[model samples]
Target chain A: MTTNGGADLTRLIEPDRVHRSVYTDDAIFAREMEAIFQRAWVYVGHESQVKQPGDYCTALLGQQPLIMVRHSDGAVYVLYNRCAHRGALLCAKSRGNTGGAFGCSYHSWQYRTDGTLESIPLPAGYEGTRFSPGAADYNLKRAARVESYRGFVFASLSPSGPALAEFLGEARIALDNMCDRAPAGEVEIVPTCFRFIQHSNWKIFMENQLDALHPYVTHESTGRAAAELERQMMARKQKPPLEYHYLSAFTTPFNEWDKLQTVNYPYGHCMLQGYMGLRPRDPDTLAYEAVMREHYGAERTERILGVNIHHVLIYPGLSVQPALQQLRAARPLAPNRTLTEIWHFRLKGAPEAIYRRALAYYNLINSPSTMVNADDLENFWRCHQGLAADGGDWVSFHRNAGQDDEHDGVIASRRGTSEAPMRNQFRAWKQYLSSSEH
Target chain B: MPVVIKKRSRKKAITPKKNSFAQFRVSDDDVILREVEQFLYRQAELLDAKRWSDYIELFDADGIYWMPASLEQITGDGMPSIFYEDRNLMTMRMKRIAHPHAWSQTPAWGTSHIVSNVTLEKVDSRTGDVSVRSRFHMMEFRRDASRHFAGVYHHELRKTKHGYTIRLQRTDMVNGEAPFDYVLLAWV
Candidate 1:
């Protein structure tokens, strides 16, 4: 609420760099939770996460605990995970079916899947009191605005903002590409996810998403190791497994990474062009292609697969790898802690092997065990620790700074490894944080 | 080679042996159990000492090391897991950790694994296969912080002409689904 005493967000962010306080100061982080996380269109769980009427999954929007549940009417709802009676957590489990309604573990206050107050301990307790059971105040509070774009649900704690569609803009292509890959024109969450806490600021994770320059340098060991294995396989007169490329692709020289472009859209959404050649002419891929052709015809199938996207950074929170059927959602815990939920999806109507391919990539690259992700995670922590100290006053994002081509608000990096995405994100960050006064 | 995509069968790989432990008669159950505990302790020693080569050699040719994301996960199929590595991939993982270019490994991690509560669930002396379960508390220190990882480990061992080898090692951490801090390079 106050901008004095190192809380001035505008003063902290610039075109090509930002003060280290943005990544370290506790006050700035709290302001971020208020201005950016609560007000912005933050992603909730997907629709498929709660497919059944009683299904529910808990998530965090900023610091507020929220639940995304399916009602009996086949609609999804996002409600505060607090009991209306005594403010106890409504759902402690990450996800589970409530049969038909949720009952708070403490007071046994029950609510319908839609968050309506279903029952209380005793009806006569509030008979003549201000607490009317029928009043909306007695029910679990719903998010101010909740919307879904192609089954990927989002919610804003603030009532007024740009609509989700308007906010998504061209970044919707990331979701479209993911769903369009499914022959049935939809995808389903594979249920379990790799959840891990990063000992770094959430923004650090976001900046790393479209950071093309870091991979080949950070993951060099992994890339070279996989490449060496692939070469050994090749020397044995056998083609290497495509999964090897998932790691080896990080060995792509700087020139090749530079060739790919990063498109920075408004609202902090940005995407890097595909560098991982996913469309290999392998047997399993051919089989999957045929399945897609059977459902969507040859031209449409090609169109779906031809949309090349390696990774898409959806502002404050999400980093999506659509082609690989994986997306990571970042939940900021504090100035020094962040939780990331790594989820992988299955394209409906695709071959089981195709699902296997995505799952393999999920395990090989995004999973915590993989050296690819391990490398990034290490840097994130180190960056946070380094920034927290007095050694560095500013974090630089000057790579191809002014070289970006801006057209009608969407900025495209001249080079793949440009820090345009980080700059673009800070641009949106300042806009959101500054506008809180209004 | 040629993208060997091994599709997992829907059927459970290991079922509870039909007859109960009471129904089966094994050759020196106590001795075998003691040997199994010693084998697991030796494996932990190898891993803690960062003996990448000897640690890898403990695995059979067709061995697997899996760390499921959730305690309830039946299989790593269609879902992402913390770790799901075959012997070949596991070898590559070890190699990466040792590579000088692995910047994350600059200050190598020091680990101490405490494998306890060893319990044998099944023993197939005829087939030279055994299933053992244990609880582990692993402490790893790197950089400026130390991380404590506690998990339930399931090891499927096969008797060889020499002692035993690991066919599968699955670690189900108590809070495995929780977000972790930075890298988990050490094998739990």
Candidate 2:
């Protein structure tokens, strides 16, 4: 468990508790960036973000800036954002079309969309020197490996590891369910996202996405207010819109949340069973269902809609609510700083009303301005602050430790409130940190 | 806090009453402009005072409070927005913020708004509707942190018997795309 400096990393994690330093120590955070984020197939960006040949988007993979660009060869490439010549950033914007090549702002060195060196200024100056344009070093350095599943692209910094699909395993259902919901069996990104920085660690945000017990407690006020309004509307003989229930559902009692289940997969991935009843007989929903039925037939449509997934945590980075068409990607900047990109998708060929429903959830429940998100962010900050103080040394994960059902390395929680997801994550974390390879 | 009950109406385009301002002389333009500015000032005051009910009362039954995520966003219907709420949703937000268990509002944040650059963009000569543009800089302080938000405000005011009520209040934040430290809980 100890590294070369004799820092006991193994002692940091226990079966039912974790050392406070895991969330606060700078050395641990740096190790995690190299061991887990760089080794794992980290999510970069959706392929839909760069649909056209020259379109490109920038993302961060464990402090390494990367560009996901579509090439003229009808293939997507993941390359380092740095210019090979002077090490300046190739693309400054978050996303844009590079036209035919990525032109560096500092030196005007241009590389093709596929990251090969297309041209460089002043070729005569480099003729007598060792500098050669054809050298692979002069071309933009690509990720060790890049793969996409259902348009969700991911890249690994290490050359050797499990394939993207093998790593995804059962967790791939999250992406599958989302795509299958679309009549055309595809989903498109909404072009823009809500980028927020939490004054907390990245793991805090990841753990919270599947913490079933906190919603009713943290968002009680929002739920109560929405429920009260719904009551008044019903009293006035009016049916409240479906959007109201989106907040009111937070009032779900703890016992009901316990009735749900969390399935933990290898590689720290986890899934929470759907609790919010997304299906309704509203006119908009009925029309959407009719279209789905027409495109997928009755049996297939029912199966797609019946996936019953609420949220999927593709550990260390992504949290996806497939049924809601929302995904949040977390990027750690420091021990106390984490940046999250919240994105919503439009199900291709689905009715506009369905997209509007997703938009409502995005703005009202997930956006930075929402009461729900505000309370969660507040708690995250407080959790980080408390962990950093000397008041506590160990953070408890003993909710239902020994009660989980395990089969073939997969853990299933007996109750939804079990901390099995955290345990599962640390299990992977320990393996990753203990490995000698970088 | 006493709740104000208002009849809610479905969304409808605000139409100016025909020739409502026909009798007004050119000299009265300044007076009308001052009134619009005063109305906006009052709205800011209510917000700063945490007078949720009073703030909600400034909106028409069908009025919309919108904060677009991008400057290019034209409609709040299909595109994602930071905020797009009708009176009902605003009322819900008001109640939630005032609730005792609203953890984010703990050690309640204080906001000071500076409203300036008030300009009357257009006056509907037919119905007396007014379109006003203004700029605002709001400083919000909580526990140990202070954050500033600067935005341009576009208000569509409907002439009412008592005064002018907001039909639409759109806030276009200059740093809408910038990364926020946490959540934005209050109106700017």
Top lDDT prediction, candidate number: 2
Off by over 4 Å in 2: A1-7, B1-26
Worst 10 residues of 1 chain A by lDDT: A1-10
The TM-scores that each candidate's chain B achieves against the reference are 0.83, 0.84
Per-model CA lDDT versus the true structure:
0.87, 0.90
Model 1: how far is A197 from its true place, Å? 1.1
Query: Which ten residues in a row are the worst by lDDT in model 2 chain A?
Result: A1-10
* Clash statistics: count for each candidate: 5, 2
Candidate 1 lDDT tens digits, A1-438: 234743467888889989888888888888899999999999998999998898999999999999999999999999999999889998899999998889989888899988899998877777677988888998999999999998999999999999999999999888999999999999999887777788899999999889899888999999998988788778978777788898889899999999999999999999999987889899999999999999999999989999999888888899888898889999999998999988888999988999988888888887778688887877888898899788868888888899999999999988999999999999999999888854
- What C-alpha lDDT, on a 0 to 100 scale, does residue A380 get in candidate 1? 88
Chain A, model 2: TM = 0.97
**C-alpha TM-score for every candidate:** 0.93, 0.94
Model 1, runs deviating above 4 Å: A1-7, B1-27, B77-79
